[model samples]
Target: MKKKVWLSIKGKQQTQDQEAEIIELLTEGELYNKDKSQYILYKESEVSGMEGTTTTVKIEGDQVTIIRLGTTNSHLVFKKGKKKYNRYETPYGDLLMSISTKNVDVEYNEEKDPIAIHLDYNMEIDGAHGSRNTLDIQVKH
Candidate 1:
């Protein structure tokens, strides 16, 4: 059993809000299965004065590759490609944004009553500026 977690980012320059929603839409609807793969969707919103833009990103494969989709210049678009594990520099700090064999790691801790999954992501964005975004996801079943 596996689940899909969706993260959305919104707000204005210098300040951005990141929200993540996890949904179990698989047939088993469980979260601690080692045989299943999890799906991830990420989105970011940027606002400048009275205008704003939102970008949606998707990551597939068993931590092999990452796919991103969004809009540029107010037009819908998709970025289909693959990149080796790498890091970039940003306003907040240094970031390593990659979806490779060793980039995205998921661990299941069963010491608690319900299992928990921990995700750590270090990434960067280009706009008027860039900021470091960090998120923690814990799921109980």
Candidate 2:
């Protein structure tokens, strides 16, 4: 079932102590597939620098993968205690970024319905410390 949902994303960069947050109501967002892996699909906003982009969030057990397509493109993998690296493409060029996941917590209902996803990680861009970040995704059904 496709439902109108609100997505609230909070991001914090440790060194700078600057916190950024955005809340978007997505009439096109859908949360489905209880028997297998779950997925969240939504479009990106213009303020985020990816106006025509679509974001796909895939959750399977303890792993989470986020893929972006359209104006900007990147594939991000988050797994507890694991480090993953990928190239992020921008209009300027492609830059390599690494993510070291410290924690991944998924909340689900009794019937295995996904409620939210929270993760904390350290990020590096081109082998330089980027930020210590936390991302919380709330699914409002």
Top of the candidates by lDDT: 2
10 residues in a row with least lDDT, candidate 2: 19-28
Q: What ranges in model 2 sit over 4 Å off?
A: 1-4, 16-28
- Residue-by-residue lDDT tens digits, candidate 1, 68-136: 333322211112233334444334454444421213434444632222222233333332223332233
Model 2 Cα RMSD, 1 decimal: 2.7
Against the true structure, what is each candidate's TM-score?
Answer: 0.29, 0.85
Q: Assess each prediction's global lDDT (C-alpha) against the native.
A: 0.30, 0.80
lDDT of 2 at 45: 80
Off by over 4 Å in 1: 1-36, 39-105, 109-114, 117-122
Cα lDDT for residue 55, model 1? 25
Give the per-residue lDDT of model 2 (tens digit) for 55-132.
888999999988999878999999999999999988789989999999999998786766788989999989985788
**In candidate 2, which residue pairs get closer than 3 Å at backbone N, Cα or C atoms, i.e. clash?**
none
